[model samples]
Target: MTQEPKGILIVDDDQDMRELLERRLRRWDLDVVSAENGVDALEVLEREGIQLMITDWMMPEMDGLELCRAIRSRAFSRYIYIILLTGKAERHELVEGIEAGADDFIVKPFKKEELHVRIRAGMRMIQFERQKETAIQALRKKNLELEQAGATIRAHLEAAGKLQQAMLPLDVEHLGGVHFESLFVPCEYVAGDMFNYFELSDTKIAFFLLDVAGHGVPAAMQSVTISKVMNPLTLRARKAPTESSGEVKTRLLNFQDPAELAASLNRMFMGPKTGTQYFTMIYGVIDTEKNRVQFVQAGHPSLILLKSDGELKAIGEGGYPIGLLPKATYFAIELDVAPGDRIFIHSDGITDCRDANRKSFGFERLHEILSAKRQCSMRETLETIHRELISWTESATLEDDLSIVAMEFK
Candidate 1:
């Protein structure tokens, strides 16, 4: 590729000096332009693409020092390299010329070779400045592109968060004579924790809380898929209204069993076809007429039962996490409770929560809260627990998804 030569401007009151410098520099392949004085130099500078200038210190209208300072005051697209020519040998005078923005200086009767070498060095500096400016512009453009991409990602995350929230059951619900309240919090835009409760029949209601193994979009996506399959309407539709009476009765009974449901979900989510993600869950069914609850806990934190007498106990065997083993076994645990008793099911996001000092909010603290708030309304108890957890962490954001469901039998 052919490289375009740079422009060099020479300004001097002496016509001979201007012509000499112009001819010498032009031989070196630079485009040369000359002016008789600083005033004419400024005019030519305005009209030409000048990159380097050699100006005499003394002139009729404007001197080299004044011209250099004037050029420095105005912002230009490219840096201008200026060399001042003067007979003054005083150190202070040289310092003064440099402070006026002169890049270099040459004597009045300078050697041709020395002037050529100095001009060559100045041209290199101009080239370097142009390259630096180009690089800076490129960097700014890249930064702007990255910022735009970040904004786009944030918008998608917000939308995903809204969808995740819609997957949850209402904040408060009532089934038969039992009252339910819940709290959910995710550290990020979406979470791996999910919970829902729905009527299985006139005599039974079912609920579950599950936590996928990780946080963020991958885990949240898995939770969403599971929620859809486990939805009450979807499960009920599987049996169909057209089924024989015996088949419908048996299918509804199977749906009300926690062990059968947990094992089925584990199988659906297991194997290589499901990838390397797994979750812990607790599924339960309440019999309003019999006043009994049947539940299964699969590698999840213990479920808390607060008796009407203000006694709290943790139930269930800490079984293997669902999807961890294809042949994993789960057992149904039944609790026949008196009226006014309450039950609490939660994901490990609560027990595993840490404070600023890295202290875990263990099951002991949870039990104490439940026992103390036994007489409180379901909403009050849930809110108190949520507030305490936030205070312990000292921040609104959590390291994982926080989910809890509490139900009080009336």
Candidate 2:
């Protein structure tokens, strides 16, 4: 269906002039309406929704200038273009008409061609305004939709963050005779860093801290997958053939050696499907009965050992990041730990964390803090480290995922 052209209203005190203008406008195929005075013209405008008007400047009761002022004062749904037909041609008269809100003017005995061109200009302005209004409405609708989508994504990310937090160690602070404490912070709602500690046997316990490459959803998902794979129950589900029976049997093979656990993880994750994804990890097992700490470092930061005699040692020489090399070999280091000795394992996010000056909170600072807090309990020491890190960066939020696990021999 085609939309009808807008009607034009003509107001004049001269009956003959009104009819003559109407005839000429109708001959040009314009939808024209006429009134003998401004008061009646207002009624026609309200009733017919006319957007263009032509009026004689002088009249009884009310005139063209008064009509323009009245229309400008009212809050109409659309803009109204007013053209004044005036006998006065002085500059001051034109300025007075403009101040009264007339959009254009035509002098006495005006040419019909000039009148038609002025009407066309008014129609073009109305069309432009309509197009601009439509574009604004469309942009508002799109902005509303984007806001809704952004809200949904944030909700999902928050739920995923809660699930990841639940996977961390619970209230098992004291397992066997060793006390444990930890801290975890992610740059986003979900973290690429993960850590956990669980008992392997009555006298043996396992713990690990791994940081997947990158941040956000992809890295967080991979971290969660690796955490599931590290579960003792899942590890035990993988059976191997026994040499004596030549039959498949469930064994805690990976749990016995931290190096083998790292190697198994590398083999499981290495492939084109994983792309350039890899992770740095420190996997360790503590034997309560033997008072020994055995661990494997796969491209992770060195483990800090604060001895009972107040001596500090930084262990590990760095190894290949897991899943990066098919033939990468991991070696486990065994150390004798005495009562009151403490071991700290962390992701590189800690030492690599930068301050406002772009200076890293390096190994020297970390070692100094550990030595100074030697007399504090495991939890206190970890808390102190966390506070210092936040202060050093001068921000409540970190640039990368930060994770730390501390253990004290009893």
Candidate 2 accuracy as TM-score: 0.83
Best by TM-score: 1
- lDDT for each residue of candidate 2 in 187-215, tens digit (9 for 90 to 100): 89999999989899999999999999999
**C-alpha local distance difference test of each model:** 0.85, 0.87
Cα error, candidate 2, residue 158 (Å)? 1.1
What 10-residue stretch in candidate 2 is worst by lDDT? 239-248
Q: For candidate 1, what is the total of clashing residue pairs?
A: 0
What range of 10 consecutive residues in model 1 has the weakest lDDT sum?
A: 240-249
Q: Give candidate 1 regions above 4 Å deviation.
A: 1-5, 35-49, 58-70, 86-100, 105-109, 237-254
After the best TM-score superposition of candidate 1, give how far the Cα of residue 392 lies from its true spot, in angstroms.
2.4
6 in model 1: Cα distance from truth in Å? 0.9
